[model samples]
Target: MTISMDQQQTLGLSPNTLKGVHHIALNVKDMATSRHFYGAVLGLHELTGDEVPETLVTLVAQGKVANFRLPDGTILDLFGEPDLDAPHADPKQQFTRANHMAFDIAPELFDQAVAMLHQQQVPIDHGPVSRPTGRGIYFYDPDGFLLEIRCDP
Candidate 1:
């Protein structure tokens, strides 16, 4: 099966207005650690997750599994206490390390993100360098996961 979506903003007709992704979820070793990297360091809004435990979170404490909404319909989810590496039986395990995810943020928002990362003492990688598609900033999460933040083309 194949699905096609063109980034078109339609006002009427059997129209289609497709944007970016809705969300992306990742695994972590610990909930608190994940929260620190994603919520504290990255400035993502801390929200309550009903399924998440309450003992470890007190409005300020690092909590499990949270979401960060990018400018587009892109949402980033950081989950915890799950497997970090692939199963040992998988033959393709050696080739999966290249996987990564990117977020679409406005240029102004990118500036704010840079400032926020600096405040958190988080190191940034490459620039707000201009690309044919958009401006982007590359950085690593607390777990050394590469993340790219870009804006509209």
Candidate 2:
């Protein structure tokens, strides 16, 4: 989506000023479970050592943040909750319940991805629904965070 000079000026922003998403940060209930889920289950490689130097020491006591590298080189930062005993906000009650992250997959691998999810017994929220542009499947992570895997038609 290119922005014209006039549009950029009107918006007080420059065209091409912003590149792309560096990473997405999410608060997870359990670090170990989330780490295993993303790294082992999803096949995302964990970025350890220097990759995650500035950890969330302040937010969580003795807690560290983990960054996983996606196939596209996008990072997914999972931060463990500061207090596990504290009550978590219900996702159903939150206005952002519909908010989710969608990962693009190769068209050929779309069905394979669905099959993997099924083999793992992960509940499918909906889809293999079709659209003009593509097909997608919605599912939840261990933390109940909604995620989608989509492939362009």
Candidate 3:
């Protein structure tokens, strides 16, 4: 699956221009629950206004947006809209599916993470399934966003 320089040029992408994820944004039904799940259960530290640039205030104001920093320093933004009642497509269903997000975890911590999720009584949608790249578990957030925590093989 390696793409050569010519192929990358044709695709209008260069490796040097590509950087890791800066942030991942999510829309949820409840701010408190989302915060507890991400901050308490998942161990992502909530970032305060003093930590983020003031320029993002407007963009983050669409809902009760709260930003958190992952262990690796990546940002995860949660937007809570209590009145958002639109039906969402089920992640388990392949048709008309929305994208799912996966977080990388150390291989040794995979089992521990699974145990923690189980202990917290989070619904496990599917897995500890083995893939070519690693082992992963698909689980739901309080708002039903399908999320995965995986360890590289």
Candidate 4:
């Protein structure tokens, strides 16, 4: 049996309507630190109040939020909720990378990104290792969330 476009949409499996991820939201312990890391260290542009939509402001009024735009226009939202607990990933577990975010960078800039991570004193948890896709450097955010910078080439 085959599924029609209308059937796919009805079942919420329509890839045509789903372009890509618009944003990723993370609960952060310290808003200022996370903001600086994403804004200053990672060099993502944080959206100002004027840049954020009024609808979003009203929706997330319970906690402070910092919106950072990736190069491709994807937004990373940091929600300020210090009390929220983050689950630690056990190295022995197969799902160590079960909840991580990866960012793409040019192959040539890979070295610079590694250097920047070091200059910022962010310890690399793993690679700068080669994979079928590309080289990647894994590190953690200030809130202990795993993050990776992979070469797009």
Name the lDDT value of residue 140 in candidate 4: 90
For candidate 3, write residues 47-78 as lDDT tens digits.
Answer: 77677535456555654678899887877877
At residue 12, give the lDDT of candidate 4. Answer: 39
**Residue pairs in candidate 1 whose N, alpha carbon or C atoms collide under 3 angstroms:** none
Off by over 4 Å in 1: 1-89, 92-95
> Which of the predicted structures, 1 or 2, would earn the higher lDDT when compared with the native?
2
lDDT of 1 by residue, 49-139 (tens): 5532242244224444565654444556665545565555676565333224666665556666566656656668877687655666677
What does the lDDT read for residue 46 in candidate 2? 84
Superposed on all Cα atoms, the candidates' RMSDs to the truth, in angstroms, are 16.9, 17.4, 16.4, 17.8
Clashing pairs in 2: none
TM-score of 2: 0.45
TM-score, cand. 1 vs. native: 0.38
Superposed Cα deviation of residue 74, candidate 4 (Å): 0.8
Kindly give the stretch of ten consecutive residues in candidate 1 with the minimal lDDT sum.
9-18
Q: Using TM-score as the measure, name the better of candidate 2 and candidate 3.
A: 3
Model 1: lDDT to the true structure: 0.56
Ranking by lDDT: 3, 4, 2, 1
